[model samples]
Target: MSTVPPLNGSWLLRGRDGSLSAYAPRDEAVWCRAERHPGLPWAPPRRIGGDQRLHAQLALGQGADGYAHLVAWRPTVPGESGLVHSTHFRPHLAALDWVPIGHPDRKGDRTGLPAVAVDAEGRAHVFARNKGGGVGMLAQKERGGWGPWRDIGGPGAHEELAAVTGGSGRVELYATTSDGILRWRQEEPGATLVPDEALEASVRPGTLTALPTSKEHTTLFFADLEGMLHAWRPGTDPVPLLLAAGPGRVSALRCTIDDHDCTLLAQRSASGRAVFAACPTEQESAGLWWSESGPQLPVGTRVALAEDAEGRVVAATLSPDGELRVARQKDEPGLALGAWQSV
Candidate 1:
């Protein structure tokens, strides 16, 4: 398979294209390709949308119905940007013909990257930062239309939104405010979003990443300004799991192995290498272990982790030179990862 940089964020979804489709940004537009199987070469990349003004950031998710969803914004004028586009790929057709989702903010207002999550009923919830630094959301209507953007009050300015689905019909969201406070929102199927208090006690600003471990639990991960990685489960106290001791970021994903809950974390080390850690949901603190699964990655390299069709954990990283490298964990029970191989 060919390797490409995650210029606009990358996503892997099953049942699309050849049962596995990968999406990323190339040049001024987003592109995607797929493979029939994990070990096979990928098909040629196909451009998604957005022309000369396409932004370098994008969000992707897949719904229960097996449709791949994508969202992005494009610049319209100097100091003014408006258009927010949404698109999806039907596994049967294997195409990404985009359609415009009405802009939530005014024409000249700055906007953050869009985050999307799908509920049990196949409805998509999209969240983003509005001009006033509060969170705004749009819901997909059952009649195949998008509802108007509603301002969900929160304290976050110019921060990307992260969201994950919990249980059958619950969704949770996270975002960091300009002042360094991480806020959250939760909702049930067909219910309004209820804002929750700040999550981690630390007021140091940082990005948020989250995944649902089970119907009753979801895990949030973030690296503070000090580059220390923290994991928080809603009802429990926050834990500082990894210390970067320097500047870097963390990415994580939740998956199942042999019917056990598993989570994988990739953090950039102080020395500019990507380090990995794995632990079960019940042994978050006791069984936490690290491994050198791949070569040293450049600082700020983007990492994405997901379970392939065969239920093996697959980690993909985009290097500074625009190459995508992949590594997979063996089917065994330990936190062991195979060597990195170029996509």
Candidate 2:
């Protein structure tokens, strides 16, 4: 059995079982079921009212109240789907309570997968692309109610959003348009969201990730279609690191290790092997080094990376054969990784 470990003091890993039902790992091998449909025998056999099949994509964030919030989308039929939200109150608990939020959508709208981030006030902000290719947002109010979905105004078709919270009352959203334009929006507590013009980065038209290093600074990372890895800050030009080109999707996370700012990136090679790299400084002079090889992953496998409170970075991936595997970095400032282990 493979397992997914929660990072950054988080206690839950939201994913789907072999049956496509929502579940959270109770341990390395045991999964606590999240589906509520009693009709589905493979899903813990509960009576919760909602769609049973959860889309493979998930967004997780820790709220100000010390609880972790998860959001996922489920397809209802050929042309409609709905968003599901769940909360984990206690770390030791095995199950989570899930509820539906926002309105259902028709299939043609091509609304991309949703992304979430928790504000300083403990409210959860959700962003997604509308059918018309504009970005839309929904936020949790201070009193525990969900605000109406409103347009944040960015022109992009099939774009994915990534969010990071900085300082006390600031949240930043990043996305790439179909035409390869990078745009961002800044929201301060109760202020309006006015996005800046498209940025001048040679990025491909795909998902991008963002990490906030300070109140006014954030680092963005993305892989071009040719498999070249790139990183960019707000005012500086993008820095490309020397790494092997592969078709694997790129994922990144920023954490402080041994008092040094470390950024970790993971992707799969063309041979279905996992590769990892670490950069300890703002400049690319340190260069990129590959970690020890792991077991072969399925082609086009998706990977997720997170850092724990101890500054250890953990990576999780679902193999093409439906097995979930995990691995961790050995120490700080070194690109070495432990052998991949199944749950």
Candidate 3:
């Protein structure tokens, strides 16, 4: 059984050189900490605060240039929230000041967390649930300017949206709605986003995850209303993979183990402990088994997975109390984890 550790969602960023920097939202501000090198201890945390009050978790997206792009919802008065963005130019460095990227509907109420994905040309596409229950998108232009918000309609859109840039540089997006799951795909790099009618997959809100398993193909994973994990690619029916105990956002990473392509998944179980599973990439028909990894986490714990500079899989967990813990892939046989390091 593989023992993959857990993290506090996708907030963990791995630089090109394998340095790790972790970010999280605490109250009205966001904080960051980083390790200068692969085996170095984490430096002290730094606060990246803004004037507005943050109402949602920070969403991170990295571009080809290795800059960390962040988006967060800041709600001032009732029914008035705006999205703010920041960029961490490099690991262990100060990020640019937070800039406002106003919400889709200026006065929209009940707006959820925003999703961001950086395209091949370094454009940051931002998606949020608008007041009309549809998705509103604002993307960066090729010339480094922000575009006007476009309502890429998805009625009854709920929770956080999922956007990913495939290895082919195409941007794909997924959103869960009252009726079913919705998607938007870019025809090519720098192309306009086109939405597909909602897929019939009955995914629980906030449980959707998109993992690019190949150069040009991506797979979608999520827990159904009954807590069953399913994997689906475009034009294919949802393939049942695991019977998770509850439904929540699942963190996934596509990497190779012993030269075999694998997709690893992590989620907080109903018991508040983190569990993991791995399978052949894009081969859900093969088979899978889940293993409990880290100890019980605090409420609102998020998990994330990434490969380090030495090609070792790393998992991180962030607790509600602002504690960040990490474990890396051990040097043994199948996927195993080293001791958890709190920093």
Candidate 4:
């Protein structure tokens, strides 16, 4: 039988360059870097941090800070710990230097999933789950510096997918909770976060994403732990849709509205292979849910999918054969994007 590695972690990025990098922790006390690019296939995974075994959410893109950040969590005590993300890249020292965000309840405990989101204003909002007191902080990037975390709402991290998006109308913050989906407009005065139970009723998931597909509209998509992909209109509930079958795991996703219909792209692994499942159907159970696979990408690849300014489906997958694959057409001319050399 082919040995299958445990699927417990995930990675995300923003760009489609030949060389794209993301972070994951293989062993305790260390985090490793996985990269992909063109020309040379990627090398094997390598350790990138000295004292981080757990990674909340790793992103390989310039944040609102306009700087690349790689943040991870490390074990502190028993149930308590903290996270650190890079605000500045240290070229001379080798690995990027980092600054700690905060510690857990019990001195050094493992606080699950410390996610950081940087808005267009360069404000880095770092959140974590189970920080005790059912409370999470919303820290502002004051003077482009970290620290001074202020309290927001909710108990602990609530694990909401928080983000900021703008159109011709205004910029708004979007998130999902047990109460359903909620919104808070930044541009509007006295903007209060309110629940959209109708929208929430549509969202039968734990993950969501909001991306601008046109010059004036934004859409959100999600896939709970289950491999189902759903889309939410700007002010509507999630229209659940089936995307794939088999014991497939969705690694990455993106949603962008095109004209009247919305498009969702997700990276999924099934039957020991990696494939991109892009749906054009506005209905939940519509479209072919197309996927591509070959003999080479057996270890499966991590898919980082996104939509361009034009709203076309663009996918980036790091193949088992070390190729950094990108494709616009689900049925494309090549099998992989480009070969990446390992370091």
Instruction: Name the top TM-score candidate.
Output: 3
Q: Assess each prediction's global lDDT (C-alpha) against the native.
A: 0.65, 0.58, 0.80, 0.45
Clashes of each: 2, 2, 9, 23
Clashing residue pairs for model 3: 6-316, 7-302, 7-303, 7-304, 7-316, 7-317, 8-302, 9-302, 9-303
**Candidate 3: lDDT of 86?**
87
Which parts of model 1 have CA positions greater than 4 angstroms off? 1-10, 16-18, 50-53, 90-93, 156-158, 178-186, 245-249, 257-259, 331-333
lDDT of 1 by residue, 1-343 (tens): 3343222223766654335666776565776666645557666666775344466667776676777777766666686665455556543243544565656674554476777887777777778777777878888887788788888878544466677777655667777765544445555584556777565355344446676777687777766666566777777777777664334335676777667677777765656566677778735785455565577776666676766677677777775455677777786766567887776
TM-score ranking from best candidate downward: 3, 1, 2, 4
Q: CA lDDT of 129 in candidate 3?
A: 82
Judged by lDDT, which candidate is best? 3
lDDT of 3 by residue, 1-343 (tens): 2222221127887865568888887757788888977668988988774455676467888887877888887775786667888888777777888888887886555477778898888888888888788888898878887888888887877867899988888788898877778999888777768886458867788788898888867898888888888998888788999897445678899877878999999877778777788999988888987788888887677777888878898999887777889999999988899888888
Candidate 2 local Cα displacement, residue 204, angstroms: 2.4
lDDT-superior candidate, 3 or 4? 3
- Residue lDDT tens for model 4, 267-312: 4456544455544434445653556553334454555554433444
On the 0 to 100 scale, the lDDT of residue 163 in model 3 is 90
Q: Which run of 10 residues does model 3 get worst, by summed lDDT?
A: 1-10
Tell how far residue 64 is off in model 1, in angstroms.
Answer: 2.4
Candidate order, lDDT descending: 3, 1, 2, 4
Each model's Cα RMSD: 3.6, 7.3, 3.9, 6.1
lDDT (Cα, tens digit) per residue for candidate 2, span 1-75 = 343222111222322221112223222222333223211232332222233566555566665455567776665
